[model samples]
Target chain A: MPLIKEGVLAEDNWQSLADEDNLVDGPIVVSLERWQEERESLLARNTPLGLRLRSDQSPALVVDDLERFSVVALEFPKFADGRAYSYARLLRDRYGFKGEVRAVGHVFRDQFLLMQRCGFDAFEVADPAAVEAWEQAVSEISVTYQPGADARRPALALRRSRPAVA
Target chain B: MYRYDEFDHTLVSERVHQFRDQVERRLAGELTEDQFKPLRLMNGLYLQLHAYMLRVAVPYGTLSSTQMRKLAFVARRYDKGYGHFTTRQNIQFNWPKLEETPDILAELAEVEMHAIQTSGNCIRNTTSDQFAGAAADEIEDPRVYCEIIRQWSTLHPEFTFLPRKFKIAVTGADHDRAAVRVHDIGLQMCRNEAGEVGFEVIVGGGLGRTPVIGQTIREFLPKQHLLSYLEAILRVYNQLGRRDNLYKARIKILVRSEGIESFSRMVEEEWSHIKDSALQLPLDEIARIENYFAAPRYEHLDDNVREFEVKRFEDREFASWVRTNVTAHKQPGYAVATISLKPVGKPPGDASAWQMDAVADLAESYSFSEIRVTHEQNLVLAHVKKADLYALWLGLRDLELATPNAGLLSDMIACPGLDYCNLANARSIPVAQRISERFSDLERQHDIGALKIKISGCINACGHHHVGHIGLLGVDKKGEEFYQITLGGSADENTAIGKIVGPAFSYDDVVGAVEDIVDTYLEYRTDGEEFNDTYRRVGLAPFKEKLYAAH
Candidate 1:
């Protein structure tokens, strides 16, 4: 599945299989190996760069490389390993990567909201109907306990002040 | 106690609904077990050996009687008529089905509670002084600061995925009953010479396989810099803590490797950059959080020394309970009463639904309707009046809650070892029960004098065996259960890591070995020295000599 979304794919399209070469010029997908092979190649290119899935990769390394590439894709090899979720969050907040994070893998409908909250903008869900469900999930909750790219003030900070009435 | 404002309540309510949807999807086969694992864990639900376990955060062990009763209802309706109080001050119910977890969480939400971040690699429950508000030497209620940390660390994005789980403990008392020294980060509240209250920060103390007492990183941190200092510590830990080895990933190893001086310098360097940022506590906001914990309207009460003494002399049982279970409160007329969960032959820290409801009722009647759960597995009513001690004793006796063994040999800190927890290697509660029975005589326990016997079913140390004065660590030798005894460990002001005695003992011989050690200490004691004093003065050598003499 694709980890980065570009002009080619829809806002909801995120999954990319290994070099199924299935690209309609939607987004520039960069695998960890591919990203490493052409780190300078992607940085010099005029398109958004993506990082594809590696089964035994740490997100910390990819997060460290964010300054060189604009768009980074974090692949979920089997969907059960949550090291990617932590990577997605660290990439967005700690490393200050403000580009699209596409979660592509055995992406299911259930994890759509949590993935989104952890800073995944575009999700490559397998089923077509799952994408629509994911869209609904993102706007479902208006509040969260954590502070990340989505919100700055923690859930408590807002409570310290009173609402201004017009 | 921190009251849930609109934001806090809204966040939990939304999370409940979100988890409800996640649960629905899982049930419909839209989510696999692998997919649902993290989601359920973030909500504090775990699929254990037999059934799903839900861990509800207690937020520094402060709870209203209403909250306690609600927990009792959850235990009665959804669980096996009981709940296990964990060392982190959270409560775990072991028998909820997968499908029923969302509903249980929804019920928990009604009382401003949830199981969020309890089991996840994210921030676990923030534990603090159980005697927070009413401690004699407290600068301010530690719960307010704990609530602040609770808000700051709850689902915090940057620090959530550390090398492993993180724990924090805070103490605002002079005596440090909260065991701050053994936490990942321990905060001790102290007033500066200028009369401003601040924290003395200690970093890298934890228990598991590599147990190390936290070293002081900051001698005295300004009150307003609390959050910022914490950010520095966590940032350092998150970036540098060893993750390649699961066993060596905790901050203790990092602190040990980096050494305290270098680690403190690094934290200071990080703090210098973020000192004036948004993370620093704004003066106004500190007041806002502190406002909730202002002392309740208390009437001037007469000092009941004569009345209490008269009652104690009148009844031997009341005197016995007062001597063992009661503690001096900061308030003139108040005393802290610890109701022991370890009655003889009962599982340690396991409270049944009826017993919980009874404690809730008692809290309402005698302790200003509040109850606190200690990490040591005892419940405290922090504000009991001296005048009402006799009546409280009688009421507690009726409910079988008055064990009169608080801080004594019978008040054992035990983990639900092999019987419940999948991580445990041996049965812990049975060993505790056997030991309690051996020391069931009140006179014997009284003679033992402020001794703590902590039992862990395994090396996970959920029973806090490393810090117990007389620690019993359960190990499996050739698939046979054996106990490893440690002496001189403590979690108080003078915290010392326990030293192991001779060879590991068989299951049947563990209690006898403990009795022999106590007998040895009694024989070698000088005047009024307690077990720890004697152990310190004579060293573990004498106990070891007595223990393995006949072997």
Candidate 2:
């Protein structure tokens, strides 16, 4: 899998640990269940902790512990299961967690832009060959209608600020 | 009547290019059908039973003559020389090659139209009253808010992929011509005691397998907070709506299972958070959108046109057409006229390219180049001068578009059942054609008066069978077609789901069953009572006994 960040393939530094795996020292990601069950131990040895949430898990469950993690990865489960998109927005806009929100599981090139708008900064792609298509996908739609967590101003605001037509 | 500004133009143009790329990928096998299905559906392209069915959204059912002509062009060039005006007030081309869809969308964009959000699990096209701006009894024009919802819901990042497809409808007038009560979210424009116009927000009224009339979540939602409130509802549904079972995914099931009070509380809580956010509509922005729907210029004239009156008195046929098709307009000299697509022994809602071009010509010549597609599968010229009514009727009669059966039994809403839809278990159009032929007599149809016969092939209820005055659901019993009947469903301000009458009627006997039901209504009805009112007063026993007497 290739990690796309800031419109280009980036090296993934965080190690995602399985439920049975031993904890490592450097930046590591664990499942939400693991974070909940081993909260005290993980926090004591917190070497740049990251939390992974499934499609059904809400970011609100970990709202109080958001500042403790440097990264929060949201799973798509499937591309059509879009609960993660709302989760990303909640993490960024509602909880105001200034951290890397990564999209994992079934993330494709076409969904890169939408995920970005919903505040995902990184995506794990199934095909490394399609990394070049990521940039094109994100920039294909230069105009949008709704205001998102992304910095791009919505068309309504742009229309209001633009000089009135004669 | 809202024209696309620069932002809209850019967005639509870019979307065309994007879809073109996706189609190219699909053809080249870079993307499988599984991955490309949602992308194509979101762009309003569907791989139906026969070929690609491209549904083009007519925003709030409004179309300029240029757009209608372009639709005609697409029908001739790409499709099978015809289009089907859908129950959602959009148009569907039933036979476009998948390869040619990008070209079709590009051409549609030239006329400031694209098929975005017309399909898929995203927020579908926001439908509204066909007579929005021109209606005499309107509180305020619903098109402004519909356009506003269109912008906010188009390519909405957070809410696109939900458990099921979402539909929203708005009705401005006291009469619910848009069928607002049967949508996922229904907005009825109303005024408070202080004379402030707002919305009565209704949530989770849908007509599919589990039909439920929506409950009022808010009695009065201030006009400015419409988008925010909608966002709140969508958020709650997206986060909590059932995704485990496909049949239970609709918001109606959620509202039903959780009860409306609890659902309303959740929506209110969510709304309180985002009601003051950027989603809150600004006054200037509302004014800007409202300006687009501002009334067309009209010359002052007396309401009574001497020529129209004389022609109506002399020509009985013309008088009958006017009495059925013409509706009152707010402007004194103007009227709203419906061009019936349901002719004798023809499929309802099927308009040939030639008819589309003819309609465009009539609209351009008489109605300020504007047209409307109604949810009843009819076309409306919403702003015709009363004096020009005779000429319009002549033009329509030549094209066979003037059926003089508006709101009559023959003007049915039938889905393209097993004929073109994979989901359909039985055929709908042939049954509708048979029923229409049975009641083809104009005088008898006028005598029946204001009966809606909606038919659906399956339980999905695309034909709005649950809301029809005489609802018919085509079912498959032992691999043969049989029709089940329901009586007294109405989709107006007083919306109610019809009750099932009795056992199903065989294909050979279904039209006769409908006739029997109508005959029963006539037999029992008092003077001035419509079919719905008659059924409401007398109950369904008479219709059921009459329909199932042989059995």
Candidate 3:
């Protein structure tokens, strides 16, 4: 899998460990269940930590533990399932998590712009040559209506600040 | 009608470019059908049984003459010279090649229109009363808030991929012409005891396989908190709505499974976090949107026109039309005229391109260049002079648009069923045509007054059969088509779901079943009782007995 960060292919330094796999010394990603089960051991050996949550899991469950992880990977499970989109916003706007939010599993280039607006910074893609497509997707739509996690000013705020043209 | 600003223009143009790119990618085999389905659906393009069907949103059911003419152009150039006005205050073109859809969208954008959110799992086009600004009974124009919502939900990043499609409706008048109670989020404008106007928010009402009437989650929500409050509700639904089963994914199912009290509590808890967020509407912004819907300048004239009364007395046909099609307006000399698309034996809501152009011209000449598409699948000239109605009727009669059956039995609502839709089990438009042909006599239709017969081809209930006075749902039993009848449903302020009367009827026998039901109603009705009132008073026993006892 190709990892895209900030619209470019980036190296993956973090290893996603399975349930029975031993945690290495470098930064590693663990499932929510594993994090909940071996919290003490993981905290004791923490070089860097990341948490992965399934689409069915709500971000509210790990709100108190958001400070312990440097990355939070929200799983899409499928492109049609949109629960993780809300979970990403909750992780950013509600819990004030200041870390990387990665999109994993069934993430496509077409949904990159929306995922970015909803506070996703890293995406796992099936092909590395999709970098140009991802760049074009993020910049295709320059205007949006509502406020999101992105820094772009919403149309409402722009209308409010500007004087009436007529 | 609200004109587009620079921001609105830019947003739509960008969206068109994005959709054009998506289409190119799909055609080039870069995107698969599964990946492209949501993209096309969000742009209001659906692959039906035949070619592509494109639904163009008429925001809040309002259109200018220029916009109507543009619609006529699209129908002529891209479709088969006709368009189907739908129950959602939108228009659908049945046959458009996949390659030409982007061009159609670009043309629509030239008229400040796009098909955004007309379909898909996101929020749909917001519907309001067709008689929004001109009705005498309206407390305020619901289009102001509808436009605000249109902008807010245009490309909402968080809610673009919901569990299922969402619908919202608003009505400012005491009477619910928009059928607010059956939508996913219904906003009824009302004044609290303190004399401040707000909304009575109704949540999770829908009409599909599992029909449910929405309950009031909030008795009074202040006007300024509309978007933030809606955001809270959507967030809750998006996070908690069922996603496992496609059949049970609507917000209505979630509300039903978690009880109204629990759902309301959860919504309130979610709302507490974002009540004062940037989603809150500033008063100036509200006023800015409201200015676009301000009342048009009117000439000071007498309320009663002697010439109109004289014309009415001289021509009985004109008198009947005025009684059924004309409604009172707040402006004294003005009136609202409904142009019935339902002729004697045609598809319920389909209009030809020439008819669209002629109606545009008529609207420009007499109706202050404004038109409205009703949720009941009809068109309205919302602002017309009372004295000019005779001339307007003459023009409409020539074009076969002057049926004078606005609320009568022949004016039915039917979906484009098995003929064009991929999901239908039986044909709906032909049944509507048969029913219309059976009740073609003008005097007889007037006698059987104010009945709404809605027919759906399948249980998805796009025709709103759940709320029709006499509802018909098409079913597939064995290898044949069958129709099931329901009685006494309504979509007005006192909304009620209809009940099934008896067994399903075959295509050949369905018209006879309908006639028997109507005959039973006529036999038992009082002097001035409508079909719905008669059915309510007598219940379904007499009608069922009349149909089944003879068999």
Candidate 4:
């Protein structure tokens, strides 16, 4: 692992990202510019379980394909570009995206915590040093809201059970 | 007055521990800012313009003296000795460091308070009439229903991440003080032909870009079907609200796009399907929640308040305070005293720690320890006895909390605009300050009568500009602040969004513009018509004509 700035992504140090036993795994995302014949051939041979999507991907390609992949990665073009944040939330909350949702590419470390809070369980931080940071981030809190898909019990559940409202 | 049972306490306790864990992870470098943002937001923490702000919900604006004292303690201990009460009946502590929010939230939970749903797209704090259980004409105590809705909406799985934030206000009076007409969904309690209580549900009323007074979707929705009907509305909004455009995502937009008729139809259809599910109100549950809000044991006293009136006439300050601050309570011996959080020239709704402590003490002594925060940016001590009014008034005056401007022009509702909020296009507090200073004369303010001047830094309408009797909207004219004034708007029984009067004014000239309008109203008003009444009878034509005619 290499040293990563507080907010900078660790994507460039992809080779240094080490995986551990029973750890969450993220799919390798081919850059939009690299999606060519050679990439297609490589993908076909490898048969990866999912594809990391970019903002430029045509909607026709992503919508209504229920069985196409186990996960769909949404790239954060920039931290300020909240379009991807909404995209990720909508994909899970509205589009019924159930598999390993990952936030990858050009993401700020600060944003990673929020992204995970919004239901993105996996991240592909592009730096080696960010791995420890990312790991530390994931374990930061336990218990979450119920309205969203997070694990925190909804406050309503904590309500005192009553007989009825006459 | 929803008493915190052990279960409620445990839930908030666990929430604090969870947030603490989240903080640890951030320190450990596990949660990146991207991952941590929503988590923090869910806990009512926000990284605003200067520092992180934590907004704690004073659910339905109701609080006990003990709870208010806790708020004061947190403000002094963690914040910069003060907190800002918001229009949603919540309080925002400015200057809370990111690291300290979990502890602050823990403190809040200790007082049976939490920041849950203060942020996020879920149902925010349910607002009710500040006069809720105490109003003279209230058919039922509204806070009881508000608490029920709060519990039902908390962690509502299906509607948590709706297209945008949702607000609900309930009122039990014919003269709707809760501003029910300007909410996403406004529920007003009414009695049926058989004397059975029910709700009149209004949908789609909101005050963002496209302000619309809610349309009555159901003239009489049975009280027992409250949750199911609300569920139906939420379901329809969730399934259809536009997710593509952030600005056009609130249910208001959907209501506009689908048209009220079609939107109501969809909600009705949905209700038909799930109205009888677990969401339906069981008679016992309503009774159980109502028990928490039952009228406190009241000492049987003389209904005639003649002695209190004589005493007030004797004391000039007390007389003025009673005239401006006290509101009629249904109980003959009691009155609701509104402690103005807006003290003349100070920022609207900013209360110091010491002030809060004083108010808490006053509440304990004078009002059976019950306090409420109004959406109009005031603190209300409900259930104050007329016999003890002088003592409470004297104590409040000592703390500079007894400003005789409960619903007066000086009691402005202004947002944390550019000064604090990153979303603001211009500053709102200074504008409010200037107006408050301009109308600092008490006699003149009384002559002017009840007028609400709500200012929103941007079109988000957090300050509820759309519902103000006179609304000031701040806009950025190429990085410089400009304000557009509106008139004839109101948020009570005759709720309507204000109409834009004329041209926008620079910040310096904005106060003059308001004065000009007020003068025009005074000059033309027939008899003792209020700002809203005059504007309505003559229409915005007179004010608008007066405002821009000279220009």
Query: What value does DockQ give for candidate 1?
Result: 0.28
How far out, in Å, is residue A116 in model 2? 0.4
Measured by DockQ, the strongest candidate is: 3
**Candidate scoring better on lDDT of 1 and 2:** 2
Q: How much is the lDDT of residue B382 in candidate 1?
A: 88
Per-residue alpha-carbon lDDT of model 4 for A23-126, expressed as tens digits?
12344434333433244553564544455566445222556653445656666664433345445545665566777666666654445555665567666655
Please state the error at residue B165 of candidate 1 in Å. Answer: 1.3
| Chain A TM per prediction | 0.70, 0.96, 0.96, 0.56
Per residue, candidate 1 scores C-alpha lDDT tens digits across A1-166 of: 2222321236533334255454434456656776676567556655555666553465566656666555566666654444566567566656678776667666766555566666877666567666456555555556554455555455545655667434
Q: After superposition, how far is residue B294 of candidate 1 from its true place, in Å?
A: 1.4
* Each model's fraction of native contacts: 0.25, 0.74, 0.76, 0.06
How badly does each model clash, as a count of residue pairs?
A: 12, 0, 0, 42
- Model 4: per-residue Cα lDDT over B197-237, one tens digit each: 99999888888878888888898888778887887788677
lDDT of 3 by residue, A7-113 (tens): 88899998988889987889999999999999999999958999999988987998899999999999988888898889988888889999999999988888898
Q: In candidate 2, which residue ranges exceed 4 Å CA deviation?
A: none
Better of 1 and 4 by TM-score: 1
Interface DockQ of candidate 3 = 0.84
Colliding residue pairs in candidate 2: none
lDDT of 1 at B145: 83
Instruction: Rank the candidate models, highest DockQ first.
Output: 3, 2, 1, 4
Q: Chain B alone, model 1: TM-score?
A: 0.97
After superposing candidate 3 on the true structure, give the runs of residues whose Cα lies further than 4 Å from its correct spot. A164-166
